[model samples]
Target: MCVNAGKDKESAQPPGCPVSRPVPAKPAQRPERVSLLSYLLRFRRDILSAQPARLYRAWMAEFRTPFFTSFLCNDPDLVNLVLTERPGDFPKSGRLFEALQPLLGHSIFITNGKEWERQRRIIDPAFESGRIREVFPAMWDAAVAAVGRLEPLADGRPIDIEPQTSHVALDVIFRALFSIPVEDRTASAVFDAFRAHQASRPMINTGSLLPLPRWVPRWRARKTKATARIIRGLIRQLVDERQADLDAGRAPDDLATRIMTTADPQDGSTFSPEEMADQVGIFLLAGHETSAAALAWALYLMALFPDWQARVAQEAEAVIDPGRIYFSTASKLKLARAVFRETMRLYPPVPMYLREAARAERFRARDVPRGAQIIVSPWHLHRHERIWRDPDGFDPTRWDTPEGRESSRRAYIPFSAGARVCPGSAFAMTEGQLILAMILRHYRVALAPGHTPVPVAQLTVRGRDGIRLTLTPRKTETP
Candidate 1:
């Protein structure tokens, strides 16, 4: 689910289940001032821990690795320049394209310039704010399904929640996009293959560090490639079928239909099956994987901090009538939205955004050269010592304060910003809010005994051993 986590777990473990993503190295394993070779070695293990802790406080930090001269920019101004003000100057990095090429091909997520813009032009219509309300029923169904699935597991015992969240999130994406439940044969195949793919795709390959040309052959793991093919192949079949339905004028009015039917604004050209598949592939990943991460983390946050949980549950109870769900209800979930927002602040789904500096630029009086790897780390920025007060604390109410509003305006980008910002930003937020509120409304979550979740960023911010929480059905009306 993590689109890019640098390398992956080095194991030949069976790939049918949810992959236990990499955990952070113990402090003893991560010493200060390591050699470039050691850094690369450690990156393959856990990319975040490989860096010095000072990155949490530094405005701008530079790393001179052989692969590229890199700068991790925490300064708000620099982040704006790269992502918002002058995005063309800092397109997506080539390394990201290389990492995701196996699954995404040349989808908008990894492409840049005219091609990326064109894809956005065609794809954005389906995800516009007004269009999201149309998909609310699918999200609600997914949430209701989640409640049913958790009913059996709502005993006093502890269970890992990551898998459940992943399952429900994938279900939401499937229903919303293709109007098919995740249990549908083809949809199930894609989901199972993805669980298998996560184990194989420690994204970085032998060619990761090398300055190889696009034409050069890159090494990808045999299993990684195989799983990627299976996933994409299944998606291709899905889009092809959808295209046929569209031709016959019987396509379900879903996200896939809207995307495939909407011609590119500039060219007035529709996407071919292959192109639609490519976009859909990224959609499944971005939509499903990231949503799962947000939900899982929000649940864990509720478990660890019950006061906030109570507040959100009360809000959910007040806003949502378990009897029937309405799209308007999503707009009324204020506390749930705040909690989800806070969860992302503490653990950004895509931990970092990598952009290559197209031209040499100076930042905070430091020289930056063309070809430098520009890193905008939400993981660090959200908790930057110089930025937010009590930076590491989980306080959903922070979003309501005057200071919080100012800081959010300056910082707070769970989804990256500007022209290349996630087209589904609004959709993701509404989904996150509604689903989270719905879950807490039916069940109370608490931290599993002796199983504290340690935050680690991979594909998305995940617990070191998966988040284990104890679930109990709320005695009130069940939704």
Candidate 2:
């Protein structure tokens, strides 16, 4: 999975016994109980460390605040009910809307009911299996570009991989969506603006939990609004040009054109430039940011477990051709896919999901009021003590085990589940596998000595200081 998740605690180890297992790093858990003020302060700092360790074993944990109640559901059945069976009974939370609203606006990420459905109807087609195959060439080029950029940094010097993966992931999205690389000026500007925006946010914003008038300003509103405007403005410019291309019948067959031209079946209407810009903003965040975080952690995990890294590298050396790109190559990356899956198991990019109860309902035999926050934390669920075997151990091969497969079916939700699942799930998986394979094929990553990344989640799970590693060029026969 991820960091060394206290597996030794399960059985008594003779004092001073080496933990033999090479587990990735896990954040230290907070005490079981704390004052509301103390909890608030901790949450403001980092959502992961603000939690109790018992959450790993807990089926459902309730958080009662002065303003609202939050239920963090660790039970897989409960999670399925909330997300899969009865999603309509739990719409997106107000707190979630308040936190991401500035950047997302009415994007499918935050919309509800008919609006969400209509948006999905238009956006979903662009990411279909066939469309993903169409975009694979762009993805391949992005991976090649990323590996080339890292050539200078692959001198065995320590490097923070967060920004490295961020750049590449953003590059991948831009290339796929707009048929332009990240080096393009407008694409670069949007990337920079988005980077600034996410760095300032937590996964959730509890600061605005208090009952305040809409007129009252929340903290960091000015900064968030400013960056959102900058990014959205750049996106609008791109949309205008693409719309012109569409009007002139010279548009590239990319994701942008696909979505902007797809008419709603019910009403023959395509997204206007304004509407397309909003969707682009969502893709920038959900597709680019989350993929970056996961890829960084995946590399960090590779550094921690050299044996697994070597296996992936071996697979890459065998399956990948350094010459012309081929879409068929993605399916052969089984070990790399496993590595990515295990990495997300330990460090899900989007750690916590927040939804609001539509009506009063009983949960775990407890009375849950309507409007209460329903928290489905992939971070906790994936590593639940009762679900996965050696939950915290970094064994990429575990996916082949009975326990792993069963646990995965019951617990895994890195891209979430049901109706609101990430629309680009397939695209992200292919992107991760290709980039990871290409990078490992060219370079070897080792955890930089004296640097231990502490996992934290505000928006997406990432290292506190950053995931640092040393990359050395692989002296292999391949490219």
Candidate 3:
């Protein structure tokens, strides 16, 4: 049975297509009228579903609050204006900062103003061009390890792939950052704690919508704090150990060493141990979780669209050398890169970026007030009805065309845009494309019969019930 059979049949392909393209999880239709309380309750389940259908076409939508107003912006120009042109006027929202404080503290992911700039100044060089290539081997090893882990799961039984991808992604971050695989006790503990923390918190900061004093004493659940502490403690241990290594002039030239030793040019200061822990927390959370989600969705999409999968596998066979996956060879996986890009478009890892107006400002002829929430929803813009042709459909080949390129320039922002854009965007693309190529080259993935991936935003976009698929070993000569 088609997973999206309930959707309009006209949008679906004619009969006898090799495989049915997977449609993203859509929100349940909203009642003609509903109270804000009811909507908020539903929103806790899935943000995408909580939205009204008209939002898919609307340029901007407003939600009123006793304390503050929030706007979801879908206009391409407006989005660019907020994210790129006037980012200083729209800082990261306080509600988001308060909600994430238990986990991220003052990590770069949440900070704004001069502090954000300082963190970025110190952290950016760690991911500079040369460093990405240096890290390629670690990413390659993790991809290969992931393939080995999945080999035993190719017996046709259903497999929940989210955990598997999470494991591999965690392994990648561990090895790349500290030169230690996730098998280490402390690393494993951090990974487990992170999972617990994510389970205990809402992916979206709905609390931001509530009008409460910034000092109202935000209440974090006990489990959330406990888990965050465990994760931070473990990260601190790693950072301290790396510090010792650096002091002894024995530190390996990995991401951790580089980040720790690279002082801020202006202040000539490094991340103190606690600060380092905070940065690592964001790195592990953002780096691994987002990539894991994207990879799982990419594989599921491949399973749903075998023709594209076959093309990817063929490209991998022709381009990727099994003996060694190098940085130079990564760009050769063009089809695989396209698949990753499209997957992000359909299910952006960080679905919506939340910011607040720093001062009263008018936008799109609407009155704005200080403290108003400004939501730039990549999820909505990527699939905006007025933007891309066949917005919801998966077409990897479209990326090569002029229209697709133009739309991407205007509307696509999976990693976001402007100066505050994710610094690790290039690293992530390499990791994602390489992993996808490696997996498709070795295994033929198919959606488990009677299973459909229900997308939900956890720390990042994930399958609510977990993505279930079957892996079959591919019998092909490695390039």
In order, candidate lDDTs are: 0.84, 0.88, 0.86
lDDT of 2 by residue, 1-479 (tens): 22333443424555555555566899999999899999998998899999999999999999998887889999999999999999999998877777777777788898899988899899998988888889999899998889899999999999999989999999999999999999999999988898788776777677667656667877765776798789888989999999999999999998999899899998878887877888998898888889999999999988887778899999999999888788999999999999999988999999988899999989999989988899999999988999998888787778898978989999999998999999899999999988999999999999898999999985688899989999999986544
- Which 10 successive residues of model 3 have the least lDDT summed? 1-10
lDDT per residue for candidate 3 within 1-479, as digits (tens), equals: 33344323434755654443446554355664678788887777678777788888899988885656899999998899899999999999887887788778899999999999999999999988778889999999988888888889977789999888888889889999999888889888887887888888777556655667777766667887798788878888999999999999999989999889889999899899889989998999889999999999999999888778999999988888778656888878888999999999998999999999999988889988888899999988998889898898888777899999999999999988998899999999999999999899989998888878777777898887889999988996533
Taking every candidate in turn, the Cα RMSD to the unseen true structure, in Å, is: 8.9, 3.8, 3.2
For candidate 1, list the clashing residue pairs, or say none: 2-459, 8-202
> On residues 338-417, what C-alpha lDDT tens digit does candidate 1 reach at each position?
99998888878888898999999998888999988899999889888888977877778898899898889888999999
Worst 10 residues of 1 by lDDT: 20-29
Score candidate 3 by lDDT.
0.86
- Which residues of candidate 3, in runs, are more than 4 Å off? 1-24, 476-479
Cα miss at 174, model 2 (Å)?
A: 0.5
Best candidate per TM-score, number?
2
State candidate 2's TM-score: 0.95
Which scores higher on lDDT, 1 or 3? 3
Question: Sorted on TM-score, highest at the top, how do the candidates line up?
Answer: 2, 3, 1
Question: Which pairs clash in model 3?
Answer: 27-49
**Model 1 spans > 4 angstroms off:** 1-29, 203-206
Single out the weakest 10-residue window by summed lDDT for candidate 2: 1-10
